[model samples]
Structures are given as structure tokens and as C-alpha cells.
Target: MSKVILITGASRGFGKIWAEAFLKRGDRVVATGRNIEALQGLSDQFGDQVLPVQLDVNDRQACVEAVNRAKEHFGRIDVLINNAGYGLFGAVEETSEQEARSQMETNFFGVLWVTQAVLPIMRAQKAGHIIQVSSYLGLIAAPVLGIYNASKFAVEGLTETLALEVKAFGINVSLVEPNGYATDWSGESAFQAKPMEIYGPVKDAFQKAVSVPGFFGQPAATAEAIIKLVDAPHPPLRLLLGSFAYPSVRKVYEERLASFEEWKAVSEAAHGSN
Candidate 1:
């Protein structure tokens, strides 16, 4: 079934692949991103099936306006892919409050703004799907990528709750947790960092991981899964986009569960009168 799809951050990486996938399927695509040249290139390649819109999702008003524009274009929106995100890498202490806030603004708050903008329309229509492209970090945490991990964790929490909240509205929310693939998705994270003398020891390991191809995550495969999920008769609440994400998530969950059980004695003290 052909439908209208709006994909945020559609100029490159996973977003770019998603736009092409939807267009290839004869679905109308409204692709949005911060890069005008990239957006123009996408439009040129995909022709009229892809509508390129350069947008900054962090701007709540602009995000809302973008949704309205989508409504005008397709008469109604069937799928919304909130894929705009960035990787802000830094150790917890190395990252200042401002850095954390910016990460939250882009990864979590921006998604919230977009979802809020679409609620009324989807609720009225009584049929819609929302796909949020998060990260494996959303389900797990690493030593250095603290800020990025926090943002993704927030995205996970929001999407999980939202899936239940909108179930009654006939709107399905799915969280996409992608591991790593070769894309400019790394961007500045590929080089720049506020290096610390203390972290100098393990820097090589992180840098090595960054340099490996296919270590980042595969954009095309991730996009392919999203296309399938959107078309699924009954899509799951979450989809792990890369081969590594699921195992990493399972390990983290298991570890967390074990810690909870190991600390049950301390937790039991909470109810004591002492």
C-alpha cells in the first residue's frame, strides 16, 4: 500500500537510505535535514516522489510547521520517521551541563516536539505509525560516549512509554536501535573531542573502533528494516537495526537485572523501621 512518509534528517546516512527506500516503493516521501545541498541532491535523484525540506528539528516551532507542511502535501500522514539525531561524545565529567543540554535538545526534546506536533493529526485519523531512530547506546552505556548514551536512553524511555500511550489512538510507536555502520554519521565524532589527560590511556581503543569500516552500523540495512516495519501487519514496539545492537542490549539488560538481584538485600532495608 502506497503511503505518505515524512523522514527527518533525510539528507544522509540512514535518513538518506530511508528516503530512497520509500520512494522506490512508490510512496511519497518528505525528506528533511539541515544540509540544503544534500537535500537538493536527494530531490534531484528521486524526482517528485521525494520532497526535500531543510529543517532544524531542535526548533520546536519549525518542527511543528514541518508537520503542518507534510499535512498539506499528502492530505494526511501515514508514517513519521523521527530520525534526526547527532552523536555528542565525551566522558560524563568532561561533558559540561551545556553539552548535555544540547544533546537532550537534539536527541530527546526534538523527538518530543515532532511527536507532539503529529499527535492531533494521527489521533483524528485514527491510523498512523511513528518510527524513532535511536541507537544501541539508547539501551546500553559506554565509558566515553556518556552524553550520546544518555540522549539515546532518553529516546528509548520516551518511545517505550509512547507506544503504550498511543496504542488506544491507533498509533503505533517503534524505537529503532541501530548499532554501527559506515556513514558520516560519525561526523565530528570521528576526530574532534575534548581530550583529557586522564582518558589518554583508552583513547586509542575508542579511536580504533571508530576507524573500522562497518563498525558504525549499516545505513541501508537499517533503513530496509524500517521500511518493512512500517509495512508490517503488526509491527513490534522496537526493532534493533544492526547485528550488534541486540546482543549488546541483551548483555546490558542481563547485567542490570543481575545487579538488581545482587542488591536486593540493600533494597529490602528501605522497608525496615530501623
Candidate 2:
């Protein structure tokens, strides 16, 4: 059976790759992006299997309308991929108020608004899947990407709670955390903060880390994992893409556990004589 999948940020990158993959397999997609013309190619190639919608996910009302349009056109929405977001690169001290808020608006609040709009429709159907495109930085942290990391961290928390809350309704929620991908996320789609000389060394170190060989994975390689996730009867709460995510995150957890154990006495003392 062909499923109705609604994907945001379909103009390019992972969203476009996954949308085409689904359409090639006969699934219907409600593909959305800020530029409708950029999405036209999907409709052109896939015919009626794709519905291109012009959307700016930061607008809460627009998010709601997009969901309504999908429900009306497809009769039901079987899957939603929240892939509309960009990276904000800068040090914490150098980040301006507007930059931080804008990052939160698109990366964090945008996901919230779209998810809220689709919840009622999915609840009525009694079966649906929500896939959030977060990053491995959501689980760990990276210098010069403080704001982007914060946004994904918020997504990780939100999706984890959503999974638990919607389990009884037969709704599945999964966080797709991809570690450094060779995409335009670091190029045209990215927002850069005004550089400060004090942080030059920090910025340089971050740049060198990313330039290392084999640090990034191919974006198209993720399509198979995403398809498998949506097709699973019982999908995972969190799915980490790319080879770097697993071992890297595992190390972070181990270090966290050790710290927790080291502070066990202090933590217990904080409870006082309750």
C-alpha cells in the first residue's frame, strides 16, 4: 500500500533525497519548502505522487495550514519528516540575541508547531509516524556550534516525551541523529555569527576538526535507514545515522556515567533531610 508522507525542507539535502526515494517506491509525498519552484522537480518527475507546497516553517499558522492541506489532499497523513532546519555556527559569547532566537524559531519551535498541527489528525487515524531530523550534537556538544547544539538538544527532549505520550495512540516518534554529513548545512543554508578575534583559535580548532578525513558521511546514504524506520512495526525512539554517531555518543555516555558516580555523594547530600 502506498503511504502518504509529508516532508518539510524538500528543496534540497536530506529531505529531497528521502522524498525522491519514497516516491520512487510509489509512496505519495506532500513535499514542502520555502521556494515552490525548487520543489517543482519532484512533481515533474513523480507526477501526482508529489504535492509541492511553499512553506516557511517558522510561521506557526503556516504550519497548521500545511497540515490541513495535506489531510485534505491525501485523506490521511501516514508519516511526517520534520527536516526543515539549518545550522547556526558561532561561539556562545559571540552569538547575538537575534541569531539565537532565529535558530530556536526554525530548529526548535518550527518542529513544535508542525508536530502540534499534525497530532489531532494522526490521533483521529490511530496510526502515524513522526520523524525529527536532529543531529548527534543533540546528544553531545560541539564548540562554535553552541546554538545549533542547543536547538537539537531541545528536539531530542521534545521527541522523547512525544514518543512516550503517543505510544497508546499507535503513533511512533523517532529522532534521526546524523553525525556531520556532507551537505549544504555548512554552506548556503548555514548562518554565521560576526567573528570576534578572541575566539579565533576556538573557531580554527573547530574548522580543523571538521576538515579531518572521513568525518562526514554522504547524505544520500541515509535514505535506506529512513525508509526502514518508517516501515518498522516498532521503531526505535532514537536512530543515529552515520558511523561516527554510535561510538562517539557511547563515549560521551560512559564519561557522563563516570561523572555521575563520582558525584554520587554530593548528589545524595543535596537531597538534605527530606
Q: Where is model 1 more than 4 Å wrong at Cα?
A: 188-191, 208-214
The sequence of per-residue lDDT tens digits that candidate 1 reaches over residues 136-235 is 8888877678888888888899899999899999998998888877777667423234767888666677788667665666566666677789999789
TM-score of each: 0.92, 0.99
CA lDDT of each prediction against the hidden true structure: 0.83, 0.96
- Residue range 1-274, candidate 2, lDDT tens digits: 9999999999999999999999999999999999999998998899999999999999999999999999999899999999999999999999999999999999999999999999999999999999999999999999999999999999999999999999999899999999999999999999999989999999899899889899999999999999999999889989999999999999999999999999999999999995
Q: Which stretches of candidate 2 lie over 4 Å from their true place?
A: none
Name the 10 consecutive residues with the lowest summed lDDT in model 1: 185-194
- Best candidate, TM-score: 2
Please estimate how well model 1 matches the true structure, expressed as its whole-model Cα lDDT: 0.83
Best by lDDT: 2
